[model samples]
Target: MSSTPDDSTAVIRKTALNAVHRKLGAKMVDFNGWDMPVEYPAGLIAEHLAVRSGVGIFDVSHMGDIRVSGRQALPAVQHITMNDASKLQLGQCQYSAMLYPQGTFVDDVIVHRFGENDFFFVINAGTREKDIAWVRENTRSFDCKVEHLSDDFTQIAIQGPRGVDVLQKLTDADLSKVKFYWFTRGTVCGLQDILIARTGYTAEDGFEIYVPTDTATSERVWNEVLAAGKEFGVLPCGLGARNTLRLEGKLALYGHEISDSITVWEAGLDRWLKMDKAEFIGRRSLERQQTDGVTRTLVGLEMIERGIGRDGYKVLDENGKQIGQVTSGSYAPFLKKNIDLAYVPLSHAKVDAVVGVEIRGNAVKAKVVPTPFYKRPKRS
Candidate 1:
């Protein structure tokens, strides 16, 4: 398939489960070439509250799933990603990024080490083809293999306080033993060959279940999960709530936070990079930049006034000098306050510093705040 022009306005295509979403009365919207549900009757705020208070299920099949396996897979993957994939143990997952030759980010992904010399990568849907091409091109000289498995499987994300409780009723797998950022394959809800991972975008406890793309199985499991989650008030959430929930957690979005123009360190995702690892794409540039310090960085901002912050809003100082721009912003339903993520000059990113967000022609007062506006209460 050919890539569509960036400015094309044709109606976005639907994922395989669009029928299920429409049957549930989801409010659909165009999201990066996919006609995805934004919210349901409960609305975005209600869905947000549900995830924070209880649990919610999301249809995340739109995300690309790529498979990499072969004898030389470890070394080939290590060369493309900034993280040290060669050191990953089986059953562990590391959030990492694929970089361009020039050291700019191509996509931020979670690489799951499922076996020796084998891994699975969950990449942003928008960058699916680009990521595949980049990996294939780099690995062509090596003996490893790479395949795009996005269409071969479906992903269901169950997130919130009661997520584990709801999921445990179906799977005999020891849910308690699964640590954060870890996963294991087991039977789930009587379904075989399930890949359950304790990772999610929401600032809550959850799991992303990977199941084969089958009609009867998908339908049965979907119905079973909804029924099992009855006690938790787990709403069928959509992309609207998902984005808000992730932003509140200060999780970086691909186009908004870590784009081709932003380096991992400058995007505040330096922790995911492994600088000490032997040569990888962008390592030298990142290492030099880290030693020299990044000029601009992504930061969290809180509105001190009534107006809600939205993406692309210009940031300014008291004197009306433009400083930065909002990358991700919204009226946080949980806090009932406007919150945003923006990139500002390193000097202006100090915590508690007062800044101005230009909404329209007026400069609204705002202050830099610590990230993850919502943190899930630690479960014992």
Candidate 2:
């Protein structure tokens, strides 16, 4: 995921594939605090199209992982996350969020159930330290053990239509059997006990593979994946393409769409908020907010005027009054238009409602539209 600057320290972390990305002429930037590739020689638009049309590989090792286990693991996970982890069976993963007591976000996460007492959390890179500390502080009373395994794995994502085909060449394991949101552990590229999850940020078919953090192993698998998908025109994608793909898919980013100040209801993630679940971290606050009702809401906007509405731009009403702010905005490469997600009052959120976004001191014409501006066609 692409990120905004948060830390100003001179020290910057790099993934194991950092050398490889540099060798491939990827333009590296200080993303949050990591020295990460923002775009490759192929550029952002081409890399985005590669994933939508065929396949593209991304070195997403900067993401953090946590292991929760022991007899009380399920209860511990349920206590921290908004989603009900008890519903997850083996090999299943669900999108969830760890929230504050006041019902705001700690970070959005993917919780995977490895066993009855074993679960893993894939957390946002930018909040690694903060999230780890939050989980530890919150779950200290539970009988489960929380292990920080952020440095143990180099996570890679092979996304787009031909992603499965590229991966199938390296392993005999039936990639077809791994349903969406589920995962399987088996040998991949001669390495044992690799975890391949059928999950991706892109609204296209893909898989996220977990391999050792060692540079040699990481690079070998990375090169093999590119070689395997050579016939399909695979591109080594970077964070620039990653951001646009998720935005077009209507996915949320941490500081942008969600934050400690933004409640689940405000972000419109009511389905996963799981208010019915017993006594999670934010349940009480969420219930109270649900009863009182939320004032502002997350809404999608499309520019009817020429300018691209960038992040932090003021959302305005017809009289040029500031009503809300653009959380995330960009030119949708796939959809071929400018779009944004913003927090606006319910009165201004109806479909086709005319609104104005302040772009460069001018009120640019925009309208409320259905989100996920680009959804992949269903496969037969």
Candidate 3:
């Protein structure tokens, strides 16, 4: 299925589970050029709540993966990425980004260390070609080899509060001992030696499994996980709920939160920007910006009036002057309030600072507030 007749005529690619999604009555839409399910018949809100309180599964096979291996892999990876890759140990992962020479984004990525000289990257689907090209071109000078492994695997994410219990039922490995941002291999659902990582985008305790891309294996893994989690209220989630979940966690989206036009400082990603690290791409530009100071920064907004401010909605100051625009916004199903993430002038980004979002040509009142609007209580 496609979002419109025009979309159907285009060369839209589908995941291995495209038919399964249609059979489940998903509302399919053209995301970039990929035919993806935006929401299920159960609706976005229901799927959102299921992940927050119970468990939800997502077909994330469309996301791309790359592998780098060689004795100089660390220097090769460090040259292209902003984080300090030397700190990564075996089977560890870190949230990092690949940037252009201008100190702006190529794409935010998750770097995983599989071995001493072997590293992997999970990059955004929309920027797959660009990211791959950037990495290959820039790191070619280093004594390392880069391989495009995107087509070899399909990734499945099981997220939410009850996600752990559901996943442990299928694997013999002791998932409870796996630390956050760590990974291990095990036979799951009779699939031999697949990678299971304690990582997710939903800001919940969860695991993402890496399985072969064959439709039969992928569907079997999907169905078995659903059946195993049926008692825990696990639902099949689509991109709509996926967006809301990541937004609620203040997770950076490549196009929305970070982009070629947006600098790392403006996106509030200082924690991952290591200036003391060995010289890397965009380091000099970021260092100069740090001295000059940032003009605008990202902030969380709570809509005070009775309307939902959507992405690209104009954010106005108290005097009805346009300041910034909403990068992401929604009536958060789990939070039960309208919330947004936006970039405004430093002067207006303070906590409790009043601002207005132009909703339907009218400036609706909103206020700046703390982020991660919802955080699950830590396990006992």
Candidate 4:
């Protein structure tokens, strides 16, 4: 249930709540060199349904947190990311990505504008070190300090329709005023300086709380949240459910949907890329890709047959020629259908376009469908 690093061998690192996950009987797996929980005793399907209907808490402490501060912080951030950091007001967050010079993704990130001279970046877990180096390497000419603060913080995401109600019980901050893509700092569960943000990967009304990594504080908050959420039927969810939830929402995974080889245009993330910006890494390449147009584009696919398409699966056209590949796929529990996200040539990316997914060497029928296979109803 628990693993420890040895003096003579390499071992995966564990989060602050690794012991707590084991105590809850979670099925643990090695995820990118981190011991993470894949599912709990309730099983992946049940956990997925719990988050869709009620509330579910996820231990997302594995995510990386980087801080950039100084007078030139904004400029440094603007130079590295594709989004316009200048448009962000204090306490606001924006979904963005950093790109390589070739126009491919370094990683998708969330930029939190904490102050005029300070910014917080939340990046993918697997690319934490690489992202930090990239940020620091690019900030050499600017008067900014890049700090890797991932080890100093523990993060938890409480998601679902009833998430706000459950978290409101423990925090004094006004949950109603926290709009989407915004964050506020306040006391939570008697602890001060907790950053609660109204953002989530599940495409639901939820909050992600960032707290210091003190063992006592982390365990206390985790336990208190679960206890308070009892009335709302909160489940301790795992990565398996998290993946399914995000996939249904059409959220991209690092290696699957977007990668070092996938450009912003091909990934359908052009909205996040600001081409008008005077300068930024990958701007030239992205501009050229935009003007010339990308040969392939990511699209949503719904399987017409019983089989489920998976990553690395080949996508075929009507003439049985391979057109693309499925990047992410799963049997969506909430929708009760098999769906996938794939990259296909421009000719085959149109909605309702017929295609075939090579499943176990057999071409299965599928159709291009609208993305975000599932969307949460807008809260009135």
Candidate 3 residue-wise lDDT, 232-275, digit = tens: 98999999999999999999998998999999999999899888
What TM-score, over all chains together, does every model reach?
0.95, 0.97, 0.96, 0.97
Best by lDDT: 2
Comparison by TM-score, 1 against 2, better one: 2
- True-vs-predicted CA distance for residue 353, candidate 3, Å: 0.3
lDDT of 2 by residue, 1-380 (tens): 22222333456888889899999999999887889999999899999999999999999988899999999999999999999999999999999999998999999999999999999999988898899899999989999999888888889999999999999998777999999899998889999989999998888899999999888999999999999999999999999999999999989999999999999999999888777788999888998999999999999999999999999999999999999999999998888899999999998999899899998899999999997788998875
Supply the TM-score for candidate 2: 0.97
Write one digit per residue (lDDT tens) for candidate 1, span 118-140: 98999987887788888888888
Model 2 residue runs over 4 Å out of place are 1-10
Which ten-residue region of model 1 has the weakest summed lDDT? 1-10
Backbone clashes counted, model 1 = 0
- For model 3, give the RMSD to the true fold: 3.0
Which ranges of candidate 1 are over 4 A from the true structure? Answer: 1-11
The alpha-carbon deviation from the true structure for residue 283 of candidate 3, after best TM-score superposition, in angstroms, is 0.3
**Cα shift from native, residue 194, model 4 (Å):** 0.8
